[model samples]
Target: MSIVAIIEFDEAGVATGSRLGDAATPVLRVDDLGPTRGDGVFETASLVHGNVQALEAHLARFVQSAAMLELPRPDVEIWRDAVRAVAASLTSQGVTSGSIKFVLTRGVEGSGVPTGWVLGTASPDFTRERTDGIRVVLLDRGYRHDVPQTAPWLLAGAKTLSYAVNRAAQREAARRGADDVLFVSSDGYLLEGPTSSLLLRLGSRLVTPRVDLGILAGTTQADLFTWAESAGYATGYELLTPDDLESADAAWLVSSVRHVAPVRSVDGRHRAVDGELTGRLNAALDARTS
Candidate 1:
């Protein structure tokens, strides 16, 4: 029944489903502002069929992202179980699907290393983004998926918690009036969406940015590729430029909660949102868990 003053965690026991709240005692959050500067790292995964989907992959990425920020690793196993336990609790209440987000902070630590972490849950409300499809605009920005020097080595590819820059990029797109923003480096390579990975359809190939090039390898995107290959689609990855995206057969902003959704427009230029492969991709993904 007890919770921490800082809301350190919103998790409970997996077997018993009891929330272990943060301590009532207050803890000074000196580094809270750092995250505002895109100084932290994070990872997320979905809960499905009463379990944490891709638990190992999520936990591994969480720590990997932390490493990118030069932050100390938390007890990842403990953190992993907390995610599972919370998802199980939700399942007990008839919630079949939801998303789990785990954020690691360098709070109160003088040297900017991770001092603690937090995780949160949201119910299966992914339909809102998926059903309507997402509007998007193209940034002259670039995709650094191949060159590490293209982005901050410390924060690149780690999925760090600090996402103000990413959020700002999204807002810039929204300012032009869109639901989401696709950020490409100024050099014209497709990095990713503000908060999701980029998935584009080219012929029969399912292509995304390679993880080495500063792209956060998306768990859901990987799942889609796995499904794609099994369904006779050739899944592939390469360093794609904005030129390629603008002319691609179809484009998508891929993420955990939204699964795979089509991009209706890009760079104030209108494109068709309705993609013939949308239903097929969704069906392939569904078959994975079903």
Candidate 2:
């Protein structure tokens, strides 16, 4: 039984229609650019214990993504209300923890406006995966690290809804019996995971790929870096390679929802899982979210 609700918004960002239950579905025009041409942007957040984690950050990114796609900037206040409305409805239905997604599409072709919505549903259980860790395989993203800077039309840094390639990479990883995919640039720099940001521990230093290299900036990674730095851990961003992952004391796929998930293996090579460090990082993450 899934507890899911899709809340629709008008052109003005006002919540118009809300539906619950398995049979309820969203009605979209066949020509909607979000579906037809994948012209849209979205942000997903973890709603834990009735609070949406990093909501302001998510909203800021949401607006930035819309701007990157040349879509109209949505009203921030209205989006907040929409999120609250969805959270309230789900809470009334006994949902304490879940995922919340905010999406905005370019609307029907030539309409010149956008269609937005908020979806809240029960969060999937990843406790086992988080505890035991996950296996990942490196996949080439087919673009050089500097492509985003030189080719703006590719929408490289923006978290747009055009995720066909990302989804396909994950499917291929699954085909190879891996849990996820770590995307590498054509230039051989370790970029990010299909759904999460890649992080590694080099002694007391925390390292992640440079965001300027076309990977989506990870909210969870940013928060963790702040907290870790305050706790006396050094953090740096540079072009990393798979060899760095192999040499790290520990590596993790970090995200707002999954928190800090240890890497059990990458391309069949076992990476050390420092349980103590993972626990500390998880604590820091939980403290920030809480």
Candidate 3:
């Protein structure tokens, strides 16, 4: 089952209200720019045991993406209400683990008003990937690590609706017989996965790639860093390389809905899985209240 909420925006493009609707029904027009030109921004947050995890961070990123696309600034309060309502509806139906994705789009062609909606649905089981782990391959992202600085027009850090390239990368990974991909900058610096962030455990320290490397800031990674600090692990952000990943005590592809999935292999070379620590990390993530 799924839930959808159509957000109503004012003349100034501020979200004023929302109404529950059928997910199977059409709410967008044929000429909406989001579908026509991929002119939009979106954020997906995980719902665990009825709790929406890292909502504020997701909302902040949503606004940043909108700004990057020059779209109307999203009204956080209204979007929050729609997200919560949809989440609550899913939880009421006994869906414990799910995802809520809210999107803002440049409205129909010639119409200045924006289109927005929030949708919620139960997530697929990720137990196997979270436990046994996945194999990944390194692929060139065709951009330098400094692309965000040199070319702001690329929208490299923004979570836009244009994901054909990312999907194509995943398909290539499949062709290579790998479960996923770890995108490396053309200059050979580690960036991030198509749908997740890379977290590496180096001894007692937890490190992720710097956010300025034209990658989305990982909300899940930030939360894990906070929890790791309390759990006696030092954390830092660095410009990492494939050597760093290969030398790490353990590595994971962390995301909103998937939580933490340890990387068990790279290019078919087996690596160690930190089952105990991975379990603890997922437990901490699943226990988040806000």
Candidate 4:
């Protein structure tokens, strides 16, 4: 089952209130720019038990995305309330694991009002991917590593509603007999996964690609880094390449809902999987309360 909360915004685009409604009900106008031109931003947060993990991080990124699209700033307090309310409702229905996605759109064309809503749904079991691991292919993202700086107009790092390319990349991965994709810059620098962040274990150090490479700073990766640091693992961000990935002791694609999915192979080339460390990582992720 799914739940929805339609956020009511004032003329200034400040969230004034929200109403719980059936997820299947039609709420958006036919002319909404979100569906039409994909002119909007969104954030999906993991819901574990009754807690919304990395909520503040998600909200911060949400506002950042909206600013990138020049949409009105989201009122954090109201949006937080709506998200928690929906999360609580889903938990009440006995959902222990799920996801909550909140979105803000540039409303119907020329309406001068933005449409917003929060949708929550139970999560699918990903035990196999988290344990058995997945295969991935490195696909060129058609942008240079410095795209975020050179072409900010492309909204490289922002998590916007425009994701046709991302979906297409996943489909292309399937056609290639891979489970997922790791996008490389046209210039041959390691970037990130379509919907996830790249993490590599280089000896005792845990590293990820630099955020400057037009990748969404991973909320899940941030949380895991914190725990990893506490657990005596060193962490850092760097400009990486396929050679770096090839040399890593182990690697994963981390995200909000899926947590950590170990990459078992790259382009059908078998890679080592650190089962012990992967278990520890997922355990730490599942234990997050804030």
User: What's the CA RMSD for each of the models?
Assistant: 5.1, 2.6, 0.8, 0.8
How would the candidate models be sorted by lDDT, starting from the highest?
A: 3, 4, 2, 1
lDDT, candidates in the order shown: 0.65, 0.82, 0.96, 0.95
Cα lDDT tens digits, model 3, 150-174, are 9999999999999989999999999
The prediction achieving the highest lDDT against the true structure is 3
My TM-score estimates for the predictions, one after another, are 0.81, 0.91, 0.99, 0.99
How displaced is residue 55 in candidate 1, in Å? 2.2
RMSD of 4: 0.8
lDDT of 3 at 4: 99
State in Å the error of residue 103, model 4: 0.6
Query: How far off is residue 16 in model 1, in Å?
Result: 19
lDDT value, residue 195 of candidate 3: 97
Q: Residues 26-79, candidate 1, lDDT per residue (tens digit)?
A: 443645534445566666666666656666777788777766666666566667
Clashes of each: 23, 0, 0, 0
TM for candidate 1 is 0.81
Which prediction has more favorable lDDT, 3 or 4?
3
Clashing pairs in 4: none
TM-score of 4: 0.99
lDDT of 1 at 152: 75
Residue 243 displacement in candidate 3 (angstroms): 0.6
Give the clashing pairs for model 2.
none
- Predicted candidate 4 versus true structure: per-residue lDDT over 34-57, tens digit per residue: 999999999999999899999999
Model 3 stretches astray by more than 4 angstroms: none
